[model samples]
Target: MDKCKVDVAIIGAGTAGMGAYRAARAHTENVVMIEGGPFGTTCARVGCMPSKLLIAAAEAAHDMKHAELFGVYPGDVRIDGKAVMERVRRERDRFVGFVLEAVESFPEKHRLKGHARFLDAHRLQVAENCEVEAGRIIIATGSRPNIPQMLKAAGDRLIVNDDVFSFDDLPDSVAVFGPGVIGLELGQALSRLGVRVRMFGASGGLGAIRDEKIRDYALQVFNEEFPLDPAASVSSVERTEEGVAVTFEDGDRGTVTETFEYLLAATGRRPNVDDLDLQNSDLELDDRGLPLFDRYTLQCGSSHIFMTGDANNDLPLLHEAADEGRIAGENAGRYPEVRAGSRRAPLAIVFTDPQIAVVGMNIQQAHDHCGGCFEVGEVSFEGQGRSRVLGKNKGLLRVYGERGSGLFLGAEMFGPAAEHLAHLLAWSVQNRMTVPDMLGMPYYHPVIEEGLRSALRDLNRRLLMGPESVERCLDCGPGA
Candidate 1:
């Protein structure tokens, strides 16, 4: 029954919403953020933080298994799943506290604990029956795990990533139903902790990643090292008294069933758009429930309404979401197209063993956009001086660039510290850095990163002789 007013109203105080609030504060007199859940964002609560904590726990377990190689023979190796969950909870709580404290630091901004649904184009209704009329709205509702409908037949038998971390006990085995980012990361983590992991997917497992070599590296790491089976596909899942029974159509299309204590439906994530009732605001939705927006400014439906992050689906990277939220907030508060357009597209990395990162366009993608004229070069870390020193022998760096222009278009890496290396390549692509220019840049020796420098040298060589004369093009070569 209470009525409130603000200049700007932000829905969902997650990463994108928090970013919008901070950016809008500089331009608006009154900025308020409305959240449905607790103060912490998913990334801080059950998403990034807790998952990484679990991965850290798994890494410890794995290290003990390899202790013999380090000349320290622990009589036997074992993992306490309960203890790992406790650590995950502790770390998650700490991170949540930090986020709650950080959100409180913005004094002029109001934080309300309630979901906000649009009452009209300019009005929003919150929990406790409160209404806030605002000049503009920024929607950053984020996303939820999308378990496939067919697999939902087993009630309470399926668990998503969010609730998986809260389990009091570890499953004896798990059948991961998708090969997306979460599936691979969690599968590898759980597998390392001694869980029998069977990973299944429809096609191009890990569809988000553009580089085939990087995907192969991920598949190899999980299947070979952690003992995960990548080619399994589930035909049905049924709840059993002891656990869950998953029937799969094997790679040869033979029927097989396996029982696991838990099943994680890590297929993908859908945008949180259904609850908003967009008809109240005249917003249009794509077939997949994403908001239709101006790609450049992120303005949706009308000038006063904006969408950011996973809600729009350009690229779901956290940094990209935060940047989009800032842009949306800034543009909504003031004039449209005030700042220079984002010249660079976002890049993504899988946090699995031998992390994979892809920036800009790969050779095939670039060729499709232009012509098949880009020069591709690759260098491996196996024989590189630095990789051998670090005890990581397997890794490769691939670069794609225009022929005569020598402008870098894309770069991908698979190996130790590849996540960090990919960002540099992303920056170079955005800046149009040339092979000769980037190659001359100082690189410290005996570091995994020097692999990038090695790739640059190979690229420079190919650029000098032209694409036709090139041989041993690692990017196009077998196994990269």
Candidate 2:
């Protein structure tokens, strides 16, 4: 057997693994990245980029259909599903090429193409022939879409994100399982692109928004685009001549049966650690079969071993995975004594129409952390100037802050320009900004940001500082 030694051996070449590679390279060149195949990161290959492409196409089709609302008349608008999917694949391949080029650019000896299995804590065997002995190891093997066992028998009729974007043609109708981020985004986009879509979730909420009001608003907006059954609980899935038949209980509405040409399962994802031979290591695993690692240092039980990205099951987003990878890489290079890094405030978004963003703690989290001491301020877009002008004057925005101190805790919103607004709120929350600090910032007139400003002002009014605090600040001299 061929044997080699390296400072670090990183498994998987996705975002997390590449991130670790770059960071580790800064400290040591004795780092090798091993992969089985499919070189591109999840975002570039399937997750973010491809989904956005489909959403963009759907948005264009939706805009054309609504052109008459703006006093524009265009007749006989047609949508070519084949062309749309072709563009998605063409652009997706271009993105994937960048990653492949980067990986290929590395020294031939530094890149290994094979599956790696841990033979011991400090050693790994790749594809039975090659052996690698590393002082430290970083596991960045990402994740794969989780398809329930009950639906596995349906075979190709049940699809996941990995294969959904690469379809040669769009299905005539689909039953979307789970109304989380993937389901809502794709289900709505597919419906807008002229497909019959029915979305069903076991829970009442949509996406990860914990604010009940915002969730309700999201359901309302999503229902307008496609049928949503949030209370659905699947009982059985059976293959049918046409496609598949699903029987689910629709809380209060009783058991219902639906047939679709295809079923898209967006329930969740499982970490790609099952085949990593983790049992050979000294690290302890949780009930989910994920290694118990420090969230700050990304270090597994052993100081020389670390787990990052979706494999850790901490934060599965691409950006979060990258951050975790950096932490793991840096600490793994440091060895002996791991260094802890600060994690950013939680930020997540659902790219549905009018969008939905959850920043930091939501309503329930704030209540759980601070009890009744937190104050909530809300602004409805029903009469917002910019939203009315854009004919999207719906949804709501709510901000939570400490009642007495006026410190911003978190925010949840389902409204226009929510993606941008969420970023703004996330930054502020990460910095622990106060209501007064946010209110003092400039807000342009007749814009969606004004809605956020209004919510902050409402929150400020509820705080003990009130308007007097602003007056006091203004009364003081420039340098006071």
Candidate 3:
């Protein structure tokens, strides 16, 4: 058995772990990273990147299918399922390769290959190969998909988002459970790619969208693409001779039975801290057994330990995970002089059609944060010039601002180019821009961003923040 002492030890080699490793190395060379799984980011292996590749293919197919709307009829659209899966796998491997290269570039002595669990507060046992005693620790072990026992009834037919990127060919049909980010994106991509898809959700929610208007608009828009019933009444799920069989309420059809090649469990993810034997440690833990750590510092209960990434369960997004890892690593490296890391405004985007983005606070969050002293500014893309011109005229956007300060609190949207718009709004929120300040920015003619300006104008007027328009008003050139 090999034994070593290090100043910092980081568990897991995903995005967060890598970031922590880099940050810790800056302060001292006495650092090591332990990972039991493959060296690659979740975004690269199974999360964002591969999913976007599939979505790109789906978008191509969808545009070709709808070309007739532009008076250019595409005679026949034949989807090569094998080809689609091939490209997804090929590009996915390339992305994973880059991550592997990064990990390999680190000193081989700094890498340990095994699952690590806490022996005590400062000791870690790495799969019988090595014993590590460190002054400080960072748990960036990441997360795995959470599957309920009910979905286990699908037996061998059950799969998760991680398994989708490795398909040899697209299945004929899929029954996707969970209307969250993974489910919505994969379900819509499959539906658009000529696969019969039925999506179900236990609760009435759409990804990170908390505003009721955007949620309902998203639900309606996506259902038109595939059968999605949030708050669904699912009777049973059983393994059939051919595939997985699911019996559920199908609107007016009233409880129908359907069988699909795969039953995707996109429910959610659980922190990977469970297998770490956290009970042996002196650190404080939540009821779920996860460590109670400071969000700003990623420090675990005033102890020498820290938690970051999905392991902490604070914010599961890759960017947030990276940020937390950096903070945790920096604090762990400097020990006893832990400082708060700069946290950016919240931003989330779902890459579905008419994409969904939530920046800063939602309506409920705004109201709670401001004690109901907030006003809403809204815009429907149905009448927006650019959206209508592009035949993508659907969805809604709502921006929230404080009533007194007129500060741009947040914005949520289900519309074309929402990902781009969300970035702009996220920057605005981070900069503490007011409604009038945002409106003062130049908006060019005949653009979707004019929709944002229109909403800002409404918010400014309602908050009495900006002077009224002087010339040919009409809310800036008919929604610009």
- Model 3 regions more than 4 Å off: 469-477
Native-to-model Cα distance after best TM-score fit, residue 270 in candidate 2, in Å: 0.5
lDDT of each residue in 1-480, candidate 3, tens digit only: 899999999999999999999999999999999998888889999999999999999999999999999999988999999999999999999999999999999999999999999999999999988899999999999999999999999998999998898899999999999999999999999999999999998988878889998898888888788989889999999999989999998768897999999999999999998889999889888888888889999998889999999988888999998899899889999998999999999999999998999999999999999999999988898988888889988979999999888899999999999999999999999999988788778777678988888788777778976584522246544555
Tell me how far the alpha carbon of residue 412 in candidate 1 is from the true structure, in angstroms, after superposition.
Answer: 2.2
lDDT of 2 by residue, 1-480 (tens): 999999999998999999898888888899999997679999999899999999999989988898888898888679999999999999999999998999888888889988998999989999879999999999998888888788776777888887878888887998888889999899999999889999888767688888888888778878887889788777888888878888887667798887899889998988899998999977888887788888999988655889999888787998899898898888877787688977898999888887888998899999988877999989888777778778777779999998777899999988888899999999999999999998888776567787787788778888767563433122222111
lDDT value, residue 228 of candidate 1: 46
Candidate 2 — which residues are off by over 4 angstroms?
A: 249-255, 468-480
Q: With candidate 1 superimposed using the best TM-score fit, by how many Å does residue 370's alpha carbon deviate from the native?
A: 2.8
Off by over 4 Å in 1: 226-232, 251-253, 335-345, 465-480
What lDDT score is found at residue 134 in candidate 3?
95
